[model samples]
Target chain A: MPAGTLYRGREGMWSWVAHRVTGVLIFFFLFVHVLDTALVRVSPEAYDEVVATYKTPIVALLEYGLVAAILFHALNGLRVIAVDFWSKGPRYQKQMLWTVVGIWVVLMAGSLYPVLGHAARELFGS
Target chain B: MSSDTTSATIGPVEGAQYDADNPAPYIEAPRKRTGKTPRATRGNFEMAAWLFMRLSGVVLVVLVLGHLLIQLFLDGGVSKIGFAFVAGRWASPFWQVWDLLMLWLAMLHGANGLRTVINDYAERANTRLWLKGLLYTATVFTILLGTLVIFTFDPNIR
Candidate 1:
């Protein structure tokens, strides 16, 4: 409970946190997604109109945010594998942390490039 | 001059004679002693995994929060998300890659975390093996399927 002290316990603690978080996100998103699809069943015209509204800049931003979540979850998972299987990896714990960060950064950058690029191009003719 | 033959056999026992004025042999012990000590060093893998959980937890806070704000708060909320909504988002390579990244990260993180849980709790060797096997199978399947959905999504699918 003291400041600057890290809590250490069982191995699955982080994974449990991640699993719960990702599960909630995925579940919530899937629910909304499925409901929106069902709108098509109610009335295709309304669904088409509603879907069209998602092209706004705000929605685009949210899409990018989702990308960040998924990337973190996946990369951290790989870190878990290395720790669980590899023998000499214990020494490289710090290195693995940095690698996860690096991967997240690279993936986010790559994912955001096209949308931001297009937005920039439209805003400023080139 | 020593009566002991075994002591003299190995080497010249210079300090074999322990007199009041003279000291005993300051035998130099071998530098590298190869034998299992009672207290073995803790497994390095477990130490690394412990470190990983803390680090990953901190990062997950940001990722999860940002995801929530966007999906559940921004714009008209969850009501706006749809197939065409996804299609429109993915039409641009940015969202495609974004979804792809999210899919991969969450699956790997969740899967690995689960794997640790299985290893720690499963009593029998077979139980641990089997639980992990199922976990890995599900994780791999979900990840691959999600990735495929992200990339191969046809906006025109009816």
Candidate 2:
């Protein structure tokens, strides 16, 4: 009934929201991905052409974002399972969420090295 | 040690109003968790779906990462991915099986996740049924098409 209750969300609530958002995003990506890959069945040239369009700067950046989303979704997904199944997971739930976030940050940083390096060369290289 | 202020205003904000249209006090509906379902009220499907997400996600970390590394990072990265590369990779049963497993697991996991979403948000029973029906159809079609593509892929079918 109160506006504070409407706006104020704890970590679990936000985490659940992010999980749903990322999961839906990945599902949409896979839809396009599958359809494009299926182009290979039609002809390799078609497949190569479709894949080549993804080499541009914007798509490259989105790919990296996709990677980050997948990483978070996967890690938090594991936490969801633990919370649902493990005996002590609820007690340490906040710790589990933080642990997943920490891993996600480290992994995203590591991934940026390869993803951004390639993107930079593609965008700037003569 | 006790510092109290009479000027502090701690109270609920005014958001609700009585409406003449409905002849009743209007209040925002409490968030309804539409969690009841055949699966929830009957079988072990939700639990299985829960377990599958974790197991498939763990395996997908390996399968998807390996696939991405080979396709997007190794051998000059995305530019190197093409007809010949895919043809060559799928030539081996190893890559074929790897892709097969990835396709199946990711699709099923994602579809199940969406099924949960539909169950939660579709609200009306008819809408939820239709949405889930559409989801399952697409899932089956993609999985079958993908499995066929993996196993029956002809490198020389030019």
Candidate 3:
């Protein structure tokens, strides 16, 4: 399928697309993460100043999105592997996808306190 | 000599019995075409990659989520995650290994996944090769630099 058709694809296909997109995003995050952490080696003052910036409302919101992406990608990635290697995995692929989705929903729900709570406080001071 | 020189032709896959509904007799199949399916270099590379993605993904879930929970949304949230915080965490070998494993697995998995994407979409062989070369170089540089910083980090350095 063409790149455009990827979004228009079925659930399994969309899962694949999500996996790839999330993987790429996380990769970029890691790239910056290393660079920023390396700043500690230069000077703790430099490191603290940069990391402190992430405490704002906007960055908190972005962090929430990052968590969502990583959660979905990680859960669906396991499903992908199951379908690839397990003997009956193909037969149960849809079920597995749903299961992953269910687990992801639960995990994200649990994380809401941390992700959105702080963001809301930072944004509205509540 | 001319009779002995046959063109490269593919025959139907073995055991494909004739069907009366599709009664057309088979001729020699078309020769290898540029757009034809590539040879199956069926190396363990792909199998290992597939396995590595899943395995690394599982580990990454734990390492990354824990790291985020600690560094971003815990104790005092991102405000608490600074040089001193990092130094404190890295003081423990557990945190150091966690960060190191997270770094290596995520980089390799992301690079490999992108490699598949490039192979799938980059039409020209040269484009594919060049793109992958660029990706590999970046991946290697980031991984090596990140690993060195993680291990050689001096916490007491003012």
- Cα displacement (angstroms), candidate 2, residue B135, comes to 1.0
**Cα TM-score per model:** 0.43, 0.79, 0.79
Clash pairs, model 1 backbone:
A15-B113, A70-B102, A71-B101, A71-B102, A73-B105, A73-B106, A74-B104, A74-B105, A74-B106, A77-B108
| DockQ comparison, 1 vs 2, better candidate | 2
The candidate that achieves the highest lDDT relative to the unseen native structure: 2
Model 2: how far residue A121 lies from native, Å? 1.6
B1-158 per-residue lDDT for model 3 (tens digits): 55434322324552356553333566777764465666664557888887888888888878887877787677766656777778888899988888888899889988988899899889999999899999999999999998999988988888
Task: Name the docking class for model 1.
Answer: incorrect
Answer with 1 or 3, whichever has the higher DockQ.
3
Error of 3 at A34 (Å): 1.0
Per residue, candidate 1 scores C-alpha lDDT tens digits across A5-80 of: 3434333345446545754465345435434544544454667776655545566566566666666665665666
TM-score of each model's chain B: 0.62, 0.73, 0.72
Q: By TM-score, highest first, what's the ranking?
A: 2, 3, 1
Sort every candidate by DockQ, greatest first.
Answer: 3, 2, 1
Q: Using DockQ as the measure, which candidate wins?
A: 3
Candidate 2 lDDT by residue in tens digits, B1-158: 12233223422333245342223455677854366534345577777777788888889878877877877666666667788988888888888889999999999989988998998778899999899999999999999888888877888879
TM-score of 2: 0.79
By DockQ, the better pick of 2 and 3 is 3
